[model samples]
Target: MRQSLLALLAKEPAHGYELKQALEAIFGSAYPSPNIGQIYVTLGRLEKDGHVRSVGVEQSNRPNKKVYYITAAGLETLQAWAEEPTEGPRVRDEFFMKLVLAPMTGLSDRMALINRQRRHYLSLMRELGELAERTDPGDRVALLLIEGAMLHLQADLDWLERCQEELP
Candidate 1:
């Protein structure tokens, strides 16, 4: 979130509301809208860290707004984040833990758990598929994001099958 804000500010100095709108425009419905308070808190932290500086802008009828600008340190941090590879998916996820520890925990229905998780993934895939279809064809970024999510869902379903096969 911090890095995302920095990148946005790098493009142009903007107030928190403007940043939120920009974020919604870019990510669309793929991500939840960030809370206004969360944005301000992140901005405060960025200011404390010297990654951003804010100035008050007065308006005739409205309270003064603080516009934030990215500093050199923020740009460097954003660049580094953009260049870094994200960590791979976790192998020992919470569901996996539940699957492995079910017997000791008196939850012996492992197949049921796997099937439930599979159903959840399938439902999400269906929703994403519908979203992709409704999205404009020219919006290549959104299409790519939807496709990537679908692929991940497919992989998850395959893993669930593997888990079922290995379970007693």
Candidate 2:
């Protein structure tokens, strides 16, 4: 989020509300929108870390707004972050932990858990499909994001099947 905000500021300075609106426009359907308070908190942290700076702009009828801008150091950080590879899939993730530990911990039947999770993923896939259909055909970025999420969910369902076979 820090890098994302920095990248936005690298384009142009914006007040917290503007930043929140921009992010919500981008990912609100696919992911949760950033809370206004969260945006301000992150901005505070970025300013404290010297990656960004803020200047208060006076308003005639409202409280002054602090607009944020990326510093030179922030631009360098954003550039380096852009070059960094995203982390790949993990081997021992939460579902894996449940598949292995749930029985021992008396949490629930493993098969029941798997069945429930499979249903959840399928439901999400259906929702994403609907989202894709509703999405503007020209918005390739949003379509690609939905497609990627669907693929990941498909992979997760496949992995659940493997767990059922091996653990049974």
Candidate 3:
């Protein structure tokens, strides 16, 4: 979230609300709308870390709003972050833990667990498919994010099948 805000500041100086709006515009419904207070807290941390700086812009009838700008260090940090590759999918997933431990814990309901998760994945895929269809065709980024999520969910469903075949 820090890097994301910094990248926005790199484009232009903006107040917290503007930054929040920019994020929403970028990610659309896919990005959970960040709380205004969370934005302020991140901005405060960025300023304290010297990655960003804020100036108070006063209004005649309202309280001053702090507008944030990316400092040189912030720009460098953002660049580094952009270049870094994201981590791949996690191997030790929570569901896998539960699947392995449930028998020992006397659940012994692997089929039930697998069926429940399969239903969940199918439901999410349907939702994501709907979201992709509703998304603007021009917004390639948003479409790709949705596509990626749908693909991940499909992978999870496939893994569940493999588990069903291998496990008693």
| Candidate number of the best TM-score | 3
TM-score of 2: 0.84
Q: Please give, for residues 52-88, the per-residue lDDT of candidate 1 as tens digits.
A: 9999999999999999999999888998999999888
lDDT by residue (tens digit), candidate 2, 1-168: 888799889999999999988987776565677888998999999999999999999999999989898999999899999999988967548878888888998879899989999999899999999999999887777788899989888899998899999996
Q: Which parts of model 2 have CA positions greater than 4 angstroms off?
A: 25-30, 105-108
Off by over 4 Å in 1: none
Q: If the candidates were sorted by their TM-score against the true structure, best first, what order would they fall in?
A: 3, 1, 2
Per-candidate RMSD, Å: 1.9, 2.4, 1.8
Candidate 3 structure quality by residue, lDDT tens digits, 64-111: 988899999999999999999998988538999889888888966888
Per-prediction TM-score, please? Answer: 0.88, 0.84, 0.89
Ranking by lDDT: 1, 3, 2
What TM-score would you give candidate 1 relative to the actual structure?
A: 0.88
Of the two candidates 1 and 2, the one with more favorable TM-score, higher being better, is 1
Candidate 3, pairs of clashing residues: none
